[model samples]
Target: MEVNNRYITITNHIQGSAKESDFELKVVPLRLSVEPGSSAVILKNLWVSIDPYQLNRMKRYSSSHKTVQPAVRITPGQPIDSPGVARVLVSDDPEFVKDDLVEGFVHWGEYTVVKGGMLRKLDPEIDLPLSYHAGVLGMSGLTAYAGLFEICKAKKGDKVFVSAACGSVGNLVGQYAKLSGCYVVGCAGSRDKVALLKEKLGFDDAFNYKEETDLNSALARYFPDGIDIYFDNVGGEMLEAAVANMNTCGRVAACGAIAEYSEGAKRAAPNMVDVIYKRIKIQGFLAIDHMSLHSDFLSTTTDYIHNGKIKVQEDISSGVESIPSAFIGLFRGDNIGKKIVKIADE
Candidate 1:
């Protein structure tokens, strides 16, 4: 069968903050079949994650292109590939049969065709929302799990601070830290987001960064004893503030720098003197690099979700046409949790 697949693509490279005008919805015919003996798999796209990091990939030049395979720059007029959940329509790969539910790199479209690899077949019997595969139970969860446990080594009685705590990965980081018996504090862009962090996500304390005039003073007030772990998501001045308020031998898990993604944004300039004097161990990481922890992360997080130990926050929009706006909302701090676009019903 052949179907018209609607997908999103940028009109040109975006250097600064992304505007909705930069993207265009394009339709093309897609064949829902794999050639004989080919390893190709055809998928009906269901859910696509809208993340701030994708903005970097749309830039003409990005350090991301050199960092991770998934972060390669997007060419104008090409379908944007994103982390997504889909149902396999046709498959030539033995690993994936027809009607298999899968999660991995999929285009921001109604359907996708992949030459095997990248895709992972999900358990058909798993009792969870398929949309979760595109967000909380997928890359966002993995990013949070790996960053907190593996990179920061979060432990009991530790004082943990998460920047952009209402965001996809940051919210999960705060929840995971609290479950680890740590005192968790999170900072968000809005009062509602801050409240969600504290009331719903179980952060010990939360504050609206936009209301604070001095970030260092805010961190000082929040963590009088100094922070043991800083999960730096919104870098720039926030990172500087966290570093200043960190305890001796503190650990910083640099998961992302959303604040610096736009053009001419100030790069994180945490005090090197404070870092050295405090013996702070700051490490940058990508979730893909910690694929070894995927099984443990999935099992533990799945248990948490089932047991009501963790609150899942998902801000989802319906339809593939909403992709660009949903994505642009990320930079505007309009989303409270993992942002996802529902392209099709399962």
Candidate 2:
């Protein structure tokens, strides 16, 4: 059967801070059935993840596009691909069947047709909410898990500092570090977020970065002994301060650079002298690069959620049309945790 599928797309390549006007809602005819012998699977998207990284993809020219194959530039008027929790409507792949719940790279639309790799069926045993599969249990969770454990090699007694600690991946990194017997400190944009980080999320200490006049002073004050591990989500001056405050042989997992996403924003330039002398290991990583640890990440994160060892913070907006605004909110720090757009109810 044919249906009118409404999806979000850009009207032009965004140069700076994304406004709602830069995005346009486009509709097209979509077939719900897959041709026999075709590998395509039709899905009804339920929950779509709104991320800041998409801004880079929306730009006319982005260095991120050259970093990885998946970071391809998004063309105007094309449906943007994003991770979502969906229900399979029709499947030509043996691994999926009708009504199977799936979490994978789906378009920002009411429905999607995908083929080949990147799509996976959800585990039946995991009783968490479907939205979790789009956030903490999804790419965001894998990002946090891989960055902290694999990249930074977080260990017991380590003093860990997380920038943008109230964000999707940063918050999880903080909690995971704490669970690993590390002292965790997180920095957010507001006092309420700081309080939530400390009180609700079990962060050892939390501070509002926006309130600080000098980031170096703030980092030095927070990490009196110097930071052993730095999980950097916001780059720019935060990274510079973290590098200066890092202990000898400290490790830094460079995640997202939300600070440098806007037009004319200065890229991070940490002191090379400090880097050479301290032997700081700074590594940038992508979640897709660490799919080898997917099973372990899922199992461990699931256990954490079930045992109440981790608390999930999600800011959800309703409907597909809310996607652009939800995405724009990330740059503005308008979200507390993972910002998700609910496309349709199950």
Candidate 3:
């Protein structure tokens, strides 16, 4: 079967802040069936995650220190891919069957044919929404789990600080810290996100960073005794503040720097004096590097979801055409939680 598949692609390598104009939706002939005896599958994408990290991949090649190299760059006139949830339409792969739901790297399109590389079948019996696989049960969830447990080594009674608290990874990190009996505080860009962090996600406290005149003073106010664990997501001024206010031997899990993604690599210059004095340790990690812990993350997070210990919120936009706007919304802080684009219904 052949179908007209609509996919999103970059017009050119992006520069500075990304705009909806930077993307184009194109339709191409798509084969809906796998070739005979080939270990390939045809998927109908249901939910696609729009992440800030993707902005790094859209940049033109540069030797400058400011540019971020994505795992894969978006070539002109080619489909842009992201971690997504899909239903198998046709399969020659032994691990997947027709109608089976799966999660992996999928393009921002109505349909896609995947050959290989890390596709996992999703449990149809799971009570949560399939879209959750693109967010809380997916990359963002694993990122939080690995960063918090493996990197930060968070413990009970630790004072935790999470920047970008209402974001996909940040929200989960705060909730996980709370589950570990830590006092968690999160910072978001808006008042509503701040409210959601404290009220819905069960963070001990939350603040709107946009309203703060001085980030250092704000951190000092929130963590009078100093923060024991800092989950650094937005790594500009927030990182500087967190480092200055870190307690002795504090752990800093450097997950991402969304602030630098658009602002041309303006990284926070942390005070080396404070780092030396407090003996603070900062480590950067990628979720893919910690795949060994994926099973543990899925099992534990699924339990937390079922028991009402972890809550998920997704800002979903309908249709493949909405992908550009949905993605551009990330930098604007237009999303309250995980930003997703729904291409089809299960």
Candidate 4:
């Protein structure tokens, strides 16, 4: 059967902060079947993730930065893609069959045709929200796991500080640190998120960075002894403050810099003197690079969620049309945990 698929596409290469006007919803005809023996699958998108990293992809190509290069530069009139949870409508591949739920890089559309790549089949036996595969159980979860445990080398009793604490990755990092017996402090943009961090996520303490006049003082109050591990998501003033208050030989996991995505050349300049004096180790990483640890992350985090040890929050916007607004909301800190758009139901 042929179906009309609505997908989000970039109107143009974004120059500054992204706006809903920058994206347009376009419809195209989709064939439900692929040629026999072709290694391709037709996917009906269930949930699509709205991530800050995608904002970098909207920009016109320039100097390559290790942290925020777009996986594929978005063309002005092409469908944009992101990691999401989807259900197979038709398959010409042996690995996937019709109705098989899968997760992989999918377009911001109701339906997509995936030609090749590793598409993971979801285990129906694991009783959890399938949308989670787009967030905590997906890249965001792996990001938090690898960034904290692998990059930060976080240990029990360590004083851990997380920026963007209530975000997809930060929330998990804080919870994981707490589970490991660390004193965890998280900083968010609002009081509600701060409360979510402290009360819901079990963060040792939480602060609203927007309310603080001096970030350095705020960190000092949170960590009197200095932060032993810093899981940095919002890199800019927060990173500078965290560095200023870092303990000797502190480990910093540079997961993201949402603050610098639209700033161009006017990015935050962290204090290098603290890095030199305190002998801090800052490591930036991509979750994809740490795929070897995926098994452990899934096993450990799933067990935590199933056992009530880890709590997760999802900010879900309904419909494929909500994609643009949801994506733009990330920079405004409009989301609490994982931000995603629900396109359809199973």
Q: After superposition, how far is residue 142 of candidate 4 from its true place, in Å?
A: 0.3
Candidate 4 weakest ten by summed lDDT: 62-71
Better of 1 and 4 by TM-score: 1
All candidates: TM-score: 0.99, 0.99, 0.96, 0.96
Question: How do the residues 169-201 of candidate 4 rate in per-residue lDDT, one tens digit apiece?
Answer: 999999999999999999999999998998889
lDDT of 2 by residue, 289-332 (tens): 99999999999999999999999999999988999999988988
Output the lDDT of residue 276, model 3.
Answer: 94
lDDT of each: 0.92, 0.94, 0.90, 0.89
* lDDT for predicted candidate 1 compared with the true structure: 0.92
Candidate with the greatest lDDT versus the true structure: 2
lDDT of 1 by residue, 166-199 (tens): 8999999999999999999999989899878878
Assess candidate 4 and give its lDDT: 0.89
Cα deviation at 142, candidate 1, in Å, is: 0.6
Worst 10 residues of 3 by lDDT: 61-70
Error of 1 at 108 (Å): 0.8
Which of 1 and 3 is ahead in TM-score? 1
Q: What are the runs in model 1 whose C-alpha is more than 4 Å off? A: none
Error of 4 at 197 (Å): 0.9
Note each model's CA RMSD in angstroms.
0.8, 0.9, 2.1, 1.6
lDDT digits (tens) for residues 1-346 of candidate 3: 7899999999999999899789999999987777788898899999999999888788885333243322667787898878999999999998888899999888899987888746899976778999999999999999999999999998999999999988899999999999999999999999888888877889989999989999999999999989999999989889999999999999999998999787467779999999999999999898988999998999999999999999988899999999999989888889988999999988
